[model samples]
Target: MTDTHEKRITQNASALDLAMRLRQMISAYQVSQAIHVAAALGVPDLLQDGAKPCDHLARVTGADEDGLYRLLRALAGVEIFTEVAPRTFALTPLAALLRSDVDGSLHALAVLNGQDWFWRPWGRLADGVRTGSSVFEPIFGVHFFEYLQQNPAARGVFQKALAGASSRAAVADMYDFSASRRVADIGGGHGALIAAILGKYPQVHGILLERAAVLEGARRYLESAGVLDRCDLVESDFFESISAEADTYILSQVLHDWNDEAAHRILSNCRKAMASDGKILVVERVLPESGVQKGPLMDLNILVLMGGRERTQKEYEVLLARAGFRTTRVLEMGEAWSLIEGVPAE
Candidate 1:
């Protein structure tokens, strides 16, 4: 071939590769939905025994055979499952995470993504960006938490999803709970972090402060974890008041659901309730100064769904200061979260 023709062909190949990459990015949501559907259908749980042919899986899952086969085939290409034979599939390591019984399961997260209450606002991302506000209330006709209060099923899915996404075990170990006699987990959903802390420190008692609707789930979870006796479940609004006399206050992944003004109110309430020598731990994903990270994505998610945003260390310091507490130190917990410790400013 001529030199000029060879150069043109190479350039064409590169352009084609670029196009394919862009196309994949454009259609990435399809893959996410497919994974959600598979999880919703209990595909991973079904495959736990062994590999199953598409027909059997479809019959068990109540999915159309041919359509399910195509779905599995596409997912196999993405390495979620392996196509070991024609129309037969087995779970990959990634697919194993969708099992509800697993220790670190993503099953609930997947189901949440597919749920109407969670996914609808994502459809209005452009509107949220334009208005600099959450689309959740507009889309659902009520505030996110209010909607959850009314819809028990959605609340269950959301709480389970939160449980799946938490680094509670890690956050529980980041500080010395031995010094704390009473740890109040303000707005703590289902009592995961507090349960972890109480489980670790047998001498420490806990107070889980959450809405009345959520206290039952928290009670059940704390009970199952065998820490129910050590915990006092309080059904109250954190913005209005927090339980008094707690030496340690935990705001686990809670503040990020509200804007600055609301977050400050919650913190101020905690400050009012806390003992003079008490410490407050804000466990959240702290945004880094530069470069790309999941923090930005989570920040956008907060904006789109809840009108909140992740903040940097300086922002946290300022916020804490505004609430009459000063950030003493930041403990780096892996996986994009950090424990921002604060003490009363006095």
Candidate 2:
């Protein structure tokens, strides 16, 4: 072949590669939603004890047998489930965790993110990217939180998902509550972290702040987690007000759900309520410096859904500085999580 022709062919091939990647990236959402559907149908749970053939599993799940077979095979291809024999699938370690009855389950998140309301907002992702507004209002005729407040079942799923996302017990794995006398868990839903801290630190007391409707689960979960002895639930927006008289304040995976202005408002509230020498611990997946941090995906997810984005360490430092706090140190935890400590700036 002529040199000019070879160069043209290589350019055309690269163009094809880029186009194919774009197509696959877009269509990947279907694979995710399919997994959600399977999780909802309890497919992994059914295959827990042993493998099952397509027809039997199909009958149980009320899915088309032939179609179901293809789905199981696809999931197996991804190491989510394993097809030990033709038309028969068994649960893989990854898929087994999706079981609804599992102690730490992501089943609620799977369902919620794949449902109609959430799905619609995601469909408008490009719009959100361009406009810097929540697509939820335009698509659903109301704000995402407002919709969640009105729907009890959806609210349960959302709150449960948030609670379930973090498997660590705050007292057991996260904080040295023994050193803390009082904590303000700002935007602390389901009271998981507060409960853990209060339960572990005999001398520590806590105030859990969140929206009124969302506090139902926090109240109940805290009581169940057995930290009710030293903690009180406050029903209010964290941006509007925060609990006073706390030595430390916490914002966990919460800041990523808002724009800088909104986040500053919340942090400033925490600052106002924080004692003069008090500290604040904001827990989040601090975006990495080198590459595509998991924070970006979550940041993007929030961008599309909640009009928010996650921040890198520098970004967090800037935001905290603006909110009258100084970023002190960051401690890395499991799978893209970090506990960032900040102090009231002089």
* Candidate 2 lDDT, 1-346, residue by residue in tens: 9999999999999999999889878888877888888887889789778888889999999999988888878887678888888788888888888888887777777877777877777778899889987788888777778888899888887877777767345423766767788788887778777776776677988888888887877877877877786787788877678856788888888888889999999898888887778998888877787865555767777887788887888888888999999888887777777888899999
TM per prediction:
0.96, 0.87
Model 2 scores worst on lDDT over the 10 consecutive residues at: 166-175
Off by over 4 Å in 2: 1-23, 167-172, 290-292
**What lDDT would each prediction earn against the true structure?**
0.90, 0.81
Every model's Cα RMSD, please?
1.6, 3.3
User: Once superposed on the true structure, which residue ranges of model 1 sit more than 4 Å away at CA?
Assistant: 1-11
lDDT (Cα, tens digit) per residue for candidate 1, span 189-281: 898888999999999999998999999999999999999999999889887888656889989898889999999999999988877898999
lDDT of 1: 0.90
Q: Which candidate is the best by TM-score?
A: 1
Clashes of 1: 0
Which candidate tops lDDT?
1
